[model samples]
Target: MKNANLFVDEAEIEVHSGTGGNGVVRFRREKFVSSGGPNGGDGGRGGDVILVADTNIGTLLDFKSARTIKAPSGAHGGSSNRKGASGEHIEIRVPIGTLVFEVGDTADVVELEESTAIVDLVEDGQRVVVARGGEGGLGNARFKTSTRQAPDFAKPGKPGQSRQLRLSLKLMADVGLVGFPNAGKSTLLRRISAARPRVANYPFTTLVPSLGVVERDDRRIVVADIPGLIEGASDGAGLGHQFLRHVERTRVLIHLLDLEAMIVEGRDLLADYDAIRRELGRYRPELLTRREIVVLSKGDLIHDESVVADLEASLAAREITVRRISAAASLGLDTLLLETFDAVYDARQEEEKRASEEARHHERVGRPGKI
Candidate 1:
């Protein structure tokens, strides 16, 4: 398990555009005529190296094995004033949330050099040309003037450009399932969505994030079951950045608590919750302000209902209410989905409103009237 199916989200690669073909210089010689005119054709343009955003790709794993990508070269000129065929452009498919970084021109190795953010590919089918192809050269037929009717000179084709690039992927999810390991997040995801993540009663069962779609009444909400977090998660410990960066884009968070484990270990439930909250705040203070839903999971394993009630009362007193549920028993899951969907809708509405306001401000500033 240590070396199998690793999730790669960041990669550095080298790309080169296709080089143009050389022009041809030819003179036509007829069987009966004394002299024939020059009939050399132009060379074809080279191909471009393009990057496209694909919704299906979830990681940058393909770039790990293949680091260098080059386009096809163009065809050379013909004898009868015919233009050569252009090279085919190559498209590199990447994840939708991929961020492209362009390395400096003077840098030889992309890894050791500094790079700047060139594009944020967030939408499906979004495309950008990373390196442009070379221009084709002119043939001897174009140089046939009255002063130099029999000119035998042809321009050489220009060489294509090359670039060094880095790509980083950040998952975009509507709801993020967050908790310590063995908190029944994977179980709940299996019951709610079609994703089949590894399930066990141990720590770090889910090493990578798993995305699933929960659809109800033609409404679909994407949920990401993030990896477990430990004490020093904010400082890159125990799946640190893997957990934090995925949680950044989520509009709502489902925080799961394993009551069965807590009771068996004789640990305080609030202490566990408080520790995670502290880590979240430490990593990003704004994460504490996100819409979080507390859920006491593994309800079926708890034989006594009084333990849940007392814990709920204790949390309610502290202004937090836990949604008691068991994925095995199919308990209290529909309500959680509804609340999460509503929260996602509200978040999207707020974003749209903010965008509209900013657009209006720009429009007003561009106009002649000062308001």
Candidate 2:
């Protein structure tokens, strides 16, 4: 069986609203009465096509293939001055973190964040009428109100228009773990959380991103482990390399390094670290700017404590704090988890602080500077 790719957020689809019911022209006549007033009833309004956000959905694969969605049409009016029944509205459920954008626009119109969980339940349930139904036409009974004795004209219902939209989803997580294949990222994740990701003794074991919730003392955080990065991952070398975009939303990054791979490449731990950093810069320079924590995995493999000390000293010389841990042995896991969690939480707070300051600065400026 083929491995499932981690990212499938972006997709395009078309949605159309229902059309209004047609107006009717009729007259009420009895055996004794020769010319009775008009009694035509108005038509009911059409149903609206709406999109809702559902937390249960993780991928956009369903909407990716769907071509179009149409709503129901309203019923026609009756002769006994009875209005037609209105059509039922259609609701579409999408995953959270979905970004809604107009087809031609480069920016997004709506961003559904986890913080908007409450708003999502309310707004997502909301029925946005992309196409409005036409107003109901007046019945012939209205002709009796004025000088016109009999009205023969009635208005027809208007049709609804279609809209094209592009939607994309970005996975939300506190930290993103990145490294080459067989780097023990999955093992580390399994050790930290209850998630049982497939652990194998080969490369590319993880085809898709796996999310795990790490809970400590009632405080929980989410972490995502993505596919291993080959040389040209940014250029789509590996499966779902484009999924790298999802990591952009993370507050911090945990970089895993397998000591064996470094040794095989004829490079030390520091060299392997730089190589991975270079790849991240190539993919997205902004990623390099995120708060990063370096981890040396497979610590148990190093039999000599002196060798571990030497590696730690080498990284420390470069002003990098390297944490050593063996996920398989469950050694130093508690320290790693606590420190990483604290770092991520601090980074998020700092980012929010900087954003608030920037907003205040913009408010003070009020307008663009004359260039």
How do the predictions measure up, each by TM-score? 0.89, 0.81
In model 1, state the lDDT of residue 9.
78
lDDT by residue (264-305, candidate 2, tens digit) is 554476766786777788877999999898888888777867
**Residue pairs whose backbone atoms clash in candidate 2:** 6-208, 6-209, 38-141
Candidate 1 error regions (>4 Å): 1-4, 105-116, 145-148, 366-371
Candidate 1's error at 305, in angstroms?
Answer: 3.7
Cα RMSD to the true fold for all candidates: 4.1, 5.4
User: Over 4 Å off in model 2, which ranges?
Assistant: 1-7, 29-31, 104-145, 148-150, 262-267, 351-371
TM accuracy, model 1: 0.89
- Model 2 residue 5 CA deviation (Å) reads 4.8
